[model samples]
Target: MEAFADWLASSELGQYLLCREQAFFDRAVADAFGFRAVQLGLTEYDFLACNRIPWHGYAGPEASADVVCDAAFLPFDSRSLDLLVLPHALDFTSQPHQVLREAERVLMPEGRLVLTGFNPLSLWGSCRLLRGRRDAPWGGNFFAPTRIRDWMTLLQLEPTATAFMAYSPPFSRGDWLSRWQFMDNLGERGWSLLAGVYGIEAVKRQRGMRLIMPAWKPVKAGSGLAVAGGNERHPVKQSVQDEISHG
Candidate 1:
């Protein structure tokens, strides 16, 4: 995982994919308003930079993370965060389904979840097959978009938006990548599923009746209801601090 992080920060191909993913995240997170937002991994880059959420932070098993912890066992309370971003975190982790389960556990009802993953049905997947599982990304598990959506469905996360990007074939050299840049526009129009990466935005849903509370009634803290207003210290933050201190 550390090798993959270094590759994303330094390699030419990594930089290209990062630029494309950044653009997608910038648009995906712009409209997701909330009190607390947490990005699960890729701590080196700020994927939540475009979010309007007042209190946002990173949590992962990295020294640079605001709260160092495993993605599959997040310290946050159930239904605590309003928005969560996972940038290629699932692809790298061995417990991808458990990580998704953890993601569902931490998000509040109606909270938004955004994730990006490499598509196995794309040109990039073909390149990975040719590489014989030799490196950081190629060796990582590549899941199809439909499979990810199916997993999200079982977790009651309704898909709101989905997009495919990085249509160009995987090339190590910058000049080769630039020459194939036109494929991006063409791929979006003709063969979207064959794109290198896919991004998904989903909202958590709750079953049963939702009663409207009277304005005069006192609202309890950590009630698992969405709160909007000035930034305040949330219970999730406290849990994060405790986890860090105890560790």
Candidate 2:
């Protein structure tokens, strides 16, 4: 966990999300929705979640809001959010299913959820094994889009688009310059099949749980006013009505 956090903190990708200029997900999402706020995984995110650049100015420098809690159990009213951005959360999370379900619950119907993660079958995943490390987090369960689509299906989220990126990790060490150049020049164009990561965009599904208040329901008076015939009055439920009316 520590090694992964260190790499994540120092990596170019981290800088992009934190600073907004380098992170592809941040830039793409900001462009797509122009959201007024976003929910970040601060509780389980360790360092990356805590130190985030607010996309909107409404949450002032110390505002600290838009709901901060566990990703697996998000503290949000269902179907009230405009967008949910999952930044490589599945790579490390133990309860990915629960986390995804919570994300699906919060997102508004037709809202977009943008997810990013490393690719398992890419060159990057292979490189991790060559270093004599059997259990590193670099490619920890890096899933292909098809596998992810299965997970998304369980949550009822529909995939809208998918994109691959980071054909080459930005050359860092002086020694890796040759490999980077070779990969960029020849590998990417011809045989560089391993992309660093993949991103996915999915639309939130509208479950049948939407609550509908009937037009004829009597409005209770203010200040704890008791209804005279509350027990006798039955509101018409849309779901039941739809089922009965359809037949």
Candidate 3:
């Protein structure tokens, strides 16, 4: 994680990816309404900066985090958080599935969950395969967006929106990256699923009972009345009938 952070802070390609991801997060989290929000990883960056939640904080293994804890076992109570952001936390975590389950447990029903991850079906994935498992980001697990959606569906986290970014190939040189900028637009317009990174916004859904009103039978006018001396004299029933007539 530290090596990946260092690369993000230093390498041109890493910086480019970071910038694009930040922009994605900014737009994704901006309209999410909530009382409490938390970012699970990438403690160095403020992924929730654009969020209007009353309380937002960072949680990670790093000392700089407001709540230092493992992503797989978050310390928050069940259904406590209104929003959660995972910025490549799943890729680096050893227990990515557990992390996602923990995310589901902590989020309230209808709470928003936003996550960014590397796509394993893209050019970037091909590069990582070529580079082997010794590099910083290449060593991390890259899950496909479809697989992630399937996982989220199992957890009842219905995907609401998604965006793909960083369509350019992973090039360390600034000039090379600039030359490939045209691919970004092309990929967004025609080949979005093959983008290097993907951001997903999902909402927690829980089964709820639909309210059903009890059926009431209407009283007939002469049913509960007694014919006493040719006069139907039931004061209470008469009052009820009067009320119903008026109504």
Candidate 4:
């Protein structure tokens, strides 16, 4: 743990933790779940995992939990949470699947899970492992995004989105400008080739499927609006618009 902390203290991603979406999601999870948000990691004081806790002493009306506990085996009940964030915890966890299964067990039907990890296909992953660097926690089993997608499928979690980040650590203080220039030119999607980490968002895929019947609902015969192929109403519900607006 101490070694990990030392490495992080020197890594550029550590510095960016505050400005990144990781920080935002950490707080968002807490807000979405009230007192149910929890973080699991190899150990406490991991900046990547710990820095996301909110400033307030807890959350909710009478209860609050900006962040709580460091137990690797979480103590939450089944379907007890709305959001689960891995916080790049998979890269270092010895029992990654076990942790993920626990998370699945605790999440509700439509719950969302986000995972962040090092990308083995990326330049950073290759150099970190093959180069045999001793300074940082590089290279154990750097995983590709596809393998993670498979795992999510097996667990009935559908990957809704995938994105890469950290496109290459700013190893030297003097090279900061160059790194930013490169990233700015390439943008995040193209930058994944060099990114230090990548994040994937997955949601539990509902087992049963729904079939929409365009003709099921009755429509006024010969209405001015064209039904096109079916009898379904042409004017989509305004509530959908409102919902999209809210979402």
Candidate 5:
């Protein structure tokens, strides 16, 4: 599978898809301020192109990666990473949930997580299905966007933004792809779920967050006025005096 991934990057169709996906990555993470940013997989795309982080790293089973490590067991320290990008890593891995757990562990509180994957509900997904999962990229699993978001929420990560891209069908020729580029606008406007890929950005929020509300309990009012004491029996004070005198 790793060999397939490396080879896919050299393919014409893969290049086109990479350019589109990388553009989305660039736009999504351009404003994400952080010191350490890591691209977990798909080294071909250079997911950190638009970021100005102090330190950046790449990790995968591929030798080209900065660190070849398991996605379910990253080498970084707990709460050390500021930004993490997983480009088509989850669906390709054996234990996707465990990989997410590792990502959450390494990310600091309020750190950003950018995940990209093939949407199972898209046209590309259907094509991959009809074509069978025997060849290079199509061989991997295609997870749904909503299910992916739910998984992030379970880890106490809040999704800040999501973008769907690569709306046109996977085409090899540059001219053919350009003609179908109008689909990108359409997908962004109305047919969002049909986009081939979805990029989701979530922040790793710490547990035990509390909402700040006014420090007061629900107040109950007496019949009209409060009770006062002694001979303070003015008209307005009579109600108070009555209650106090009765007591």
Candidate 6:
């Protein structure tokens, strides 16, 4: 699994999928604004090339990466990153929920998170199951889109859009792949949830309510009329009572 990046970089099927994903990712994250952006897991693809972020880093497991670390244990301060892109990381990780929680921890409030995964309800997934081969991605665990959506919701990540890509079945030949390209249109409209791969964009949200307090002071009774001596049994009132008694 360590050389999986190199294997994928040179595979014919991988090349085809990369071409399809490049455009989809560019559109999904090109206009995103951020000071720093990260591409995790798939190191060969620069999916954030069109993004406007100043700093972009790529990381992979047991591979040459700008920052070599685990996705579940990101080495960044809390709320430091503006954007994050996980290129099929969750689908290929042992702990998908932990990776998501880490991403949410590093992202600033309202920061955008873009990620992709292999859809288990698609032809490519069926092929993976039939092959029963131990490879980088095929060996990885594929997840359903709805399941991922539920995970995102639990992490307080608000899903903005979910796009289906690579509608064509996994084919090595250009002619056969081109023939099946019509599925892109039909799959996008009707069979969207059954796409081979899916990319979801979500925004991190902080849910704490703001606290407001009003100023308060001790209240004294009869303070306003204390100077007038209206009903305090004062010496002046006592002298008036004595004169009334004498009369």
TM-score of each predicted structure versus truth: 0.83, 0.61, 0.86, 0.63, 0.81, 0.80
User: Could you tell me the lDDT of residue 102 within candidate 4?
Assistant: 75
lDDT of 3 by residue, 1-247 (tens): 6678788998999999999999999999999997999998889989999999999889998778999999999999999999999988889989989999999999999999999999989999999999997988898899998899999999999999989999999988999999999999899898986699999999999979999998989957655555455555553466665776699
Clashing pairs for predicted structure model 5, backbone only: none
Q: Judged by lDDT against the true structure, how good is candidate 6?
A: 0.82
Off by over 4 Å in 3: 212-247
Please list the C-alpha lDDT of all candidates, in the order they appear. 0.89, 0.58, 0.91, 0.58, 0.84, 0.82
Q: What tens-digit string does per-residue lDDT give for candidate 5 at 1-247?
A: 4755664567776776777788988998898887899999877558898898989999888777999898889999999999999988887888999999999999999999998888889888988988998876787778898988999999988888888888998776778888999998888898987898888999999977688988798755444443345333323356655766699
Candidate number of the best TM-score: 3
Off by over 4 Å in 2: 1-5, 11-23, 34-36, 42-68, 132-136, 169-193, 207-247
Candidate number with the higher TM-score (3 or 4): 3
Model 1's alpha-carbon lDDT is: 0.89
TM-score of 1: 0.83
Q: Give the runs in model 4 whose Cα sits over 4 Å from its true position.
A: 16-35, 42-72, 133-135, 169-180, 189-191, 208-247
Off by over 4 Å in 6: 1-4, 210-247
Residue 199 local lDDT, model 1: 98
TM-score of 4: 0.63
Candidate scoring better on TM-score of 3 and 5: 3
Question: Using alpha carbons, what is the TM-score of model 6?
Answer: 0.80
lDDT of 6 by residue, 189-220 (tens): 88975588889999998998888888788665
Per-candidate clashes come to 0, 3, 0, 3, 0, 0
What is the C-alpha local distance difference test score of candidate 5? Answer: 0.84
Model 4 is weakest, by summed lDDT over 10 consecutive residues, at 55-64
RMSD (CA, Å), candidate 5 to true, equals: 6.1
Summarize candidate 1's per-residue lDDT along 1-247 as a digit string, tens digits: 6677888888888899999999999999999987999998889899999999999989998889999999889999999999999998789889999999999999999999999999989999999988877787887789998899999999999898899999998998999999999999898897896799999999999876889977897657773332235245444455565666699
Per-residue accuracy of model 4 over 107-194 as CA lDDT, tens digit each: 7787777767777776667667666846456634577888888888888888887776665454545356345646634755465566
**Would you list the rank order by TM-score, best first?**
3, 1, 5, 6, 4, 2
lDDT of 4 at 67: 41
